[model samples]
Target: MTKDIHLYTASTMNGWKPVIFLEEAGVEYDLTHIDFAKKQHKHPEYLQLNPNGRIPTIVDRSNNDFVVFESGAILWYLAEKYQKFLPQKPDERSVTLQWLMFQMGGIGPMMGQAMYFQRIAAKQGEENLFATDRYVQESRRLMEVLNARLAKSRFLACGEYTIADMATYPWARAFYWAKVQVEDLQHLNRWFDEIDARKATQRALTIPKPFWAFFGKGNVEVQERENADRFKSDVISRSNI
Candidate 1:
């Protein structure tokens, strides 16, 4: 198939969301690495594609070169265009969107803040225990909500896996990076492990290559610190969270 979808992304959680959807859908797409360190995303040309100047923007050349920004929006767009992942029924579709919104408005932001406060903030000598604790606590609470939902449902939206699962799994898998524990949340762990075991998810995670891939044989701590520093520079410096 022709690679018409152009994905400009890095190896962040949000970036992986749509890629996983694309891979699972068996869609061919080209990739452009948006280098945060080089400030490529801030260029005027890139800004035209995404006013927010964020990673994980997509240009659908097949659709009149249409552009989609925001990770959740990208997932929804792909699911709708392909008629997969998202249910056709109104009630099921609404429930899927609800969980997708939960991840967008709750899990992503809270865990992102938890990551900043727990890892990057201390490294920058601007550590605030209050902020760290607050986000971590909130993240845990959100995890519990997810766990409760997963305890009853096979997936986040319905019996079958949907875009909601695709949107949330990447963030949940990185819980440790956010300083939130999941060992106690059996349902959450079950849900996470099942998603993690998928072949498409494993493949999508390496798009543009993950941060640790550059380190190879380097010291683990050095690699982690560098990754955290990049996260701070790319995300924390730009937004309030």
Candidate 2:
């Protein structure tokens, strides 16, 4: 089948997974920038494809025009379709899946809640102290779990670069903005630096062009404040919940 993948994504951690794997696998894909400022993802047309109305949905034109939502699923879909990143051996693949699940179930949700409370919840009040502290602590704990794993293995699973790494790298790489103590986790820093230097990873970081300048690791500080400002002013401030 001719590779016809259209990636609908915004500039977020989960949004990077599919494009990262695609770039790493050398697969061709089209990027459809989802402008959250316009609520593009929640449009009736987009909802027909992904009711979840989330960023990072994929439309696979080669596969009967199938649409895949949820970034984790998109990562698995592309990995299996291209036979890249994900391991071939059962044991290694299992380990990789375990780490992927760790990100989806543990880090993503905890960090998301922490971010919402710390950033968006300002609309509700000054700061959601309880929710922010609770989720941030949980996020830190998850980072510690990952740091411990990296202390032993160079990568998260099977000692090789796999979807597990692709799945978690963006989130882990955001340790500073996530309010994580970077010095407390030297092992993860080493691992993140290695991945950050890869050429493929470099390409993956820039999904929609003309906007890549704001997405680099070094530019994270400015981007973080900008993202929070955009979210708060554009959406959260206008929303009661």
Candidate 3:
């Protein structure tokens, strides 16, 4: 029999979302690593899989070899397919999708641009201060919006854990690298801690097959500290992008 799902991914914010969904929804799947440094995603074969040429593409082998790309789209797809994390009621579903869109359109893009400008561009001595400052602030602002929404409820949408949470969680925590002060955002911090403590989430965020920012499977604290240091320095000298 064919596999249930085949996920082509690297380890990162967007890439990790579908993995979490598959695990939380209890879907069987196999993961194939895409080498970012090798430009593996842009290869012709991978291009056939995802025309946009990105990670987190999935072929639903169990579903007639259907393919899906774009992290947000994948999250929505998994939620619908499993009818697990997404709300079923119409109003609730709309709200859930709204927050998912918040991440897809706002948080993810801003954070990515901010990191690239702050970490990669700055180190190259060709930093676009204007772009960096704008995106960092925008990313921080988006986080604060999330913090405010979370303040009103335990989760982002439907007042419960849903794909909205899955979509946003990975990118939100990277505010550390964005130079955003999240500690003051009490509700956001609380939600983050709660999700971080989930058994499934813990499993997701590991050295191997888990969620975003897997602390790896070693001295977790030491690894986190090292990452902290790198993020604080804007990753100026890092070879890996």
Compose the digit string of candidate 1's lDDT tens values, residues 66-159.
9999999999999988899999999999999999999999999999898777667677667789989999999999999999999999999999
Check candidate 2 and list the clashing pairs.
Answer: none
Give the per-residue Cα lDDT of candidate 2 at 95: 90
Candidate 2, residue 170: how far the Cα is off, in Å: 0.4
Tell me how candidate 3 scores on lDDT: 0.79
lDDT of each: 0.86, 0.80, 0.79
Which stretch of 10 consecutive residues in model 3 shows the poorest summed lDDT? 207-216
Off by over 4 Å in 1: 212-220, 231-241
Query: For residues 5-86, could you state the per-residue lDDT of candidate 2 as single tens digits?
Result: 9889877788888888888888887888888878898899999888999978999998999999998888888889888888
TM-score of each prediction? 0.92, 0.89, 0.86
How would you order the candidates by lDDT, starting with the best? Answer: 1, 2, 3
* Count of clashing residue pairs in every prediction: 0, 0, 4
lDDT leader? 1
